[model samples]
Target: MPPCASPLLLRRRLSTRPPHREHPKLAALLDVLNPPPPSSTPLPHALSSAFPSPSDAFPLRTLPRLLPRLPSPLLSLRFLLWRLTASTPQPSPHALSSLATSLPDLSSSVPLLLSSSPQPLPLQHYALLLNLSTHAGLFPASLAVLRHMRSFGLVPDAACFHHALRAAGSAADVSAVLEIMSGSGASPTVPVIVTAVHKLASAGNFESARRLIDKMPEFGCVPNAVVYTAMLDGMYNFGNLDGAVRLIEEMEGSGLGANCAPNVVTYTCLVKCLFGKGRVAEALGVLDRMAGRGVMPNRVFVQTLLEGVCMEQRVADTYNVVERVVGDRGMSSEQCYNVLLICLWRVGMTAEAEGLAQRMMKKGVQLSPLAGSSMVRELCVRKRSLDAYHWLGMMEENGVLCDSNVYGTLLLGLCEEGHLHEASALGRKVVEREIHIEASCAERLVELLKQYGDEELASHLLGLKQRPGGLSF
Candidate 1:
């Protein structure tokens, strides 16, 4: 404007303006370029996060308080499953009670989450809950869950009814069973009747069990495959041979053999009872008849017959049975041979036992621990270290460390036999794996190793004396 304002003059004038303490635009740009970092501390997780995280998994008794406390339905159900499926065979009574009592609440929450989700809640979930409650002897809780599922229009599958029936007792409980029997949604399943029959037979009430089956159709339930099987088992259990024979006839006449009706178990139970009454010929005949009906003997059935023969000290018969099982393509050789190996030892047939063991080793059959320890000890005593270690390797490969005392037996025997190399090597493995040795044996081992100039191994053996799991004398 004033001679088009010289470019140099304009730039100098802009630079000479008063300095602003805060350049809002520049500050905004700078903040955007380098934003502040978030706080270092972690955010809070739901209290239910403790599930399967460590505290609530093992020794499941600690799960009671956490059961109902979990917020999400999915979390609650997962917690319940974790507690029930834990390695502990039967959870402590306290845990069982807590789980049983909390099952209703936990189950109530499941539908809410499922309702919004694409997947619907399954009847099996309720049945699983019923099974847990039933096994815990919480009949009221079991029935309560059953009623809840029914209220929610959830029909139990066969397994679920079986679990519920297992908890059935008292007048009210039996009424509940009948109710399920008569209910239009889900009739009594074979497993359910089988459970009832088994419970009756267990309590020596065979008549009631029979009557329950006879009345199945009255309640709109069809007798499934296991129905006659259960009845046969009950009759055999009560020593009613005529009743059992009739049930088998009925099963055969009813075309139950479509799936080999009166399966291996039916024949096995009858054979066992016959053997108990000193009716070996009849038992064998039963086996022949069942085989004629296309129900071949399984490993358990054959092994059980051999067990009876062995108990009676029929050495020749036991061998023959085992030989037959082995030669027959129908039977599993490993199971038969494994049982025979134990049987030979039990009957004090040591020479025969050793021969059988070698044959088994060649065939890769692992002798079970029941006789495995005895075999290993005997082998070592005979200075068959190679054979002993070979069988031990078989046991290891099979993951069937049949005897915990085997290591101690070997170490004592090996050291005494002057097998220093084996003793040293085995001792190192035992220590590394933290297998405890007998206190007396460990002390002796430490001395022996040190005497043989294995001071390091001796120290390791000595160190084991203070550890809790180390072998006790």
Candidate 2:
């Protein structure tokens, strides 16, 4: 075996051999048993000499150091990332640690190669490794990689710094990183500045975070809608809803000089902040203002509103919020209204949930499975067959409750209430939809219709088996 080959590697090689061929290959392999150490040549020479065939395995440990000499090093960086991010059986912690430890030197050398290549360097390599290290809870190593980028006169993008900031141990470390980024002659992208603000906010240095927003101009990236939105998210997460409001006022009244005024997203984040602090009434006011400006809440924003209302059990405000969002353009997803409706039911506000369900039906909005089931069940129990049919029709139109017995149950309740016309209409629908009910229920409905001399209704009920609309499960 070669001198560098470990016992495990020898076993691996032998395991791939056929029993008969092992003896023959063993003799040939023995001829090249003693291998020399890696050469002392520089990386450019080493790589140029090594890559004629490109598939040869070399010492993985030294590749990062040698990578800078290549015109476009990402070719090899791709291989490195493949090893680091693979899921089924990941690389050893020791190996990953070793690779991350070498990042600074790799980043430092990368800039030297950039002067020759005209393409935008795929610096995502170092950033990706930094992200993985940070995700793996290797914060110090992630920071080391950041410093390495600076040492090499390289600038990592916003996403790279996002991971580092999240992994930061304290507010001070966050400030130190921002300082390094600013001093490194790296032109800060807007996202990078926003990430810095977010990190500082998370670290509870609200004062410093606000200052960073003010200082964004120095980086030649004026705060825009996206940047201000980040600040709003950070401020809220840091538990300073009041500060978030002040920042929004500042952005609106004072202006961010590049249309940084609170748009829908700004109001969206503001709405979250308001509801986060139990200011549900105030959140509604913000929504009105946003809508007045011709920018309505998106699905994500409305969903956030629903979540906060549910979390705090804000029963009184739930209906109004649901009504407004459901009636708006582009905000009324079935998921959003369902959460709002379900929140009402979860907090014991059945009356309010029923009211909202009625409103959703009027608007032709789809109901989620749970919401649809709850409303239909409650309406039927209240002997409100008309309302149940109305809402059920709405839900059916929206293509939900397809595989549920709830429709069958609702039909039975309608029949029992002696609303023969409504019951017959639903019976025809059941036949058309091919929805399943219990055998006895179906037979009872058919027998009742026949006794009442409603031959058409009884025929529809009996024809259920001939249709292809049976419920799926």
Candidate 3:
């Protein structure tokens, strides 16, 4: 037989017999040389010796074409039927074998299954799709799935609503979310609704949030403690201390009292707001009120109060609060100590600030950037330049990454002490190390040098070529 005729006979046999059981070695060799016929053909008994049954053989050849034509809806139905009837179902040896034969085509099967399902897909399946869509940022597809869910007469539970709300929030389509919620005929539980409200409030849509709160009762949904806390957070976030307080009063009138006392977060929000508005006394009163309500102040709340004291320049009071907070709870957090350090420095209590820093280091309290920077400033103010430099180095050694502001403080301190050469060296080091230097600090250093009658030093420090007169040095 001619070489070409042998291949044609082998192809005819493969077309008639099962592709899987064909002579594996010989067919592999044939595939490399004489290609199969363009159209399928029946095999004679003589060719059957080389190839097996048609069932397995044809799929291997026709799969590429059939796969492209395989309707998704049909595939989904097949899957559903298989799943429903798969009691005591063992693994399909044929399916696995087919998969191995065409591994690259497996992905295409997924869309086929999804498109073919006649009824609504299962919730779990939808959830998986939703997750994929969310990760891919396919909002329109997710929304379509949601609508598909409703069309199938399926009511979305809280978790589904929560995921949808999150998707909507991410998309920044609050109006679309509200429309979906209203049309769904499904009322979200307290947690889901509160999350929606909080999202709106955070976006500064307090009016809409308040309206939602009012409408909650109409929906036969009562606000839970979490909802109240969310409202308080929103009010505080919007800088409406009065409104937040009024909401607190409403909670009390409704016999809710402050039993919830709001969490540490709520208290911190209110305290920070009061401090921002310079109502330090009011802020302190809120702290007292929180304590009276048996809501123990956490580290954050204590830190906020300490910040208020610092802002008010109440050094003695700030120290007292710090000591009280630390002693009462045995919680000497770095934030609390940092606040104390700032307060001591502002009040010119240099020794006290230094003592506090030492105590913090001994207690193993990690110093925040601001706190470490403040300590450096205090040391420099007292002409403890070596100590300041040592602390900055220690900070770097400990993996405490200092920002541009900290470098500015260090440079300013060095310049103020007339260590122009050291300051210039450090500035150059900063540029080399790619440490950001604040523009304000740079300007301030130049101004200070001019005031000290050191025009040449200022020019050198600023990397300026021409020195100007009438600079008021």
Stretches of candidate 1 off by over 4 Å are 1-46, 49-129, 147-158, 168-176, 180-185, 204-225, 252-260, 326-328, 332-335, 343-355, 358-424, 430-473
Q: What is the lDDT of residue 96 in candidate 2?
A: 54
- lDDT for residue 134 in candidate 3, whole number 0-100: 44
lDDT of 3 by residue, 1-473 (tens): 12222435546665565434322443442343333556353222223444344334433333322322222323322322222221323223444233223322332333454555567876766654454344444455556667777777787666666655655553255556556766888776777678777767766777777787778777788756577678777667667778877766665454654443366666777787778788888887775676665567776677677767766767787767766666666356566777767766766767767777778777777777877777776676678665687788777777666555566678788877877766766666665665544555667877986886767655655652211211211
lDDT of each: 0.63, 0.63, 0.60
Deviation (Å) of 273 in candidate 3: 2.3
Q: Candidate 1, 342: how far from true, in Å?
A: 3.5
What TM-score fits each model? Answer: 0.55, 0.52, 0.46
Candidate number of the best lDDT: 2
Local lDDT at 123 for model 2: 67
Among all candidates shown, the one with the greatest TM-score: 1
Model 2 misplaced regions, further than 4 Å: 1-125, 150-159, 314-316, 326-336, 339-365, 368-398, 401-473
Please give me the total number of clashing residue pairs in predicted model 3. 12
Model 1 Cα shift for residue 441 (angstroms): 14
Per-residue lDDT tens digits for candidate 2, residues 1-473, read 11233534644655565423212333222222212345455433343343432223323444444333222333334335433322323435555555545443344323343333444434655666665566555566567767767767777766777777666777787776677766765666776677777777766788887787777788776767777778778878889888888888887775556478777778888878887678877876876777766776776677677667766766666666767776775555566677777666655566778777778777877677877787777767778877888878877777767335666677778777888777878777777776666556667777777777888866666655221123222
Q: What does candidate 3 score in Cα RMSD to the true structure? A: 19.6
Which ten residues in a row are the worst by lDDT in model 3?
464-473
